[model samples]
Target: MEHTQPEQGGLRESKRRDTLQRVAQAGLELFLARGYEATTVDDISAAAGISRRTFFHYFKSKDEVLLAWQTGLVESLRQAVLQEENRQAPLDALCGALLKLAADYDSDATFAIAQLLRSNDQLRAANQVKFLQLEQAAFEALCHLWPQRRRRGRLRMVAMIGLGAFRVGIDEWTEEGGTQPFSQRIGHAFTMLRAELQVASAAAPSQ
Candidate 1:
């Protein structure tokens, strides 16, 4: 039997990943503590113990660094949705996945991140782009649970609707000062969404 050779550059790749995470985390901290506009690239590099050139080697701008940090959650969110593959209702599965994601978030940190993302014009625009990427990720994950050709459209819809409710839920949770658990806020939003869907279904004409 032939044995696969050990992976190349394993330690170097890991060190690179660690350095990137450190820089991104540091950038987020400064953005939260000093406001996004006030935090400089040097501030993040100093916090992460890297030079400005090293920072640029990892990221183009501070905004990109922060968004890159936020993007880390996307893979986790995708995995959460995939874990719901055994559930019967696609909509319920999507909401359950969302709630799973919500439960994992630190409420205070989540609220702070929300505020940070919405604090400035550039971040706000980037946040919107991030939402679109999330929606696409959700749709692709849902397709794994229901691969039927006819179900594709509905699965796509579920992804869009689920994320929409989730976004609104987070906005409301932050607006309320994060007193409520993020899971409960998201649950309520999904409930209201289900009610609205039921009404729309009932009002539609029979085929």
Candidate 2:
């Protein structure tokens, strides 16, 4: 029975993920078809073949359903950073982990959700909250990954730069309607940031 417990636990978690995915898919379909303002929780629940209570179990509100991808991305980035093994510079490691995430991103779903957030005031607010949560998580992970620089504020600065690049990459990708791959756009953004950093370093006076 003890051995079966882990298996059962995994199965339960898998079911939960499935339910959440279904709810999100249903919500997206309805939102796209009828517009975000016209779609209701009941509409999503019915479309997903689940009861309203079950819909609430998976998502707190309609806006949350749209932001669910952000939660997944944060967790993925956390795991990637934790498992990273390359002995590169701290900032390089952080940027590499972020680029890995961009490479594996779902551009279509992201573009669709971004469009919804832009059209709805409430969803945009919710997205801002999610962004803050992601920023905090990334900053803490960077500090842990490079403890020596944490106190001097260098890690914090690196985290900010990394996130800035990510945000700009996503914004540009969304602006293009996701026509180009997100990973390519993110790589370009990082390259530009690195070049600017190099120029700044070269211009700074030596002590």
* C-alpha local distance difference test of each model: 0.87, 0.79
Model 2 accuracy (lDDT, Cα): 0.79
Top TM-score: which candidate number? 1
Against the true structure, candidate 2 reaches a TM-score of: 0.83
For residues 50-133, write the lDDT of model 2, one tens digit per residue: 999999888889988767656677777777676665367656877788888888875676677777887867877877776666
lDDT accuracy of residue 17 in candidate 2: 91
> Over the stretch 1-207, how does candidate 1's per-residue lDDT look in tens digits?
233333446767889999998998998888878988899999999999999999999999898977876766788778888998655788888898889888988568778888887778988898898888888888988898888889899889888999999999988888888889999999999999999999999999999
Regions of candidate 2 where Cα sits further than 4 Å from its true position? 1-17, 149-152
Model 1 misplaced regions, further than 4 Å: 1-8, 85-87
Model 1 Cα displacement at 70 (Å)? 2.3
Q: How well does candidate 2 match the true structure, expressed as C-alpha RMSD?
A: 2.9
| Candidate 2 steric clashes | 0
Clash pairs, model 2 backbone: none
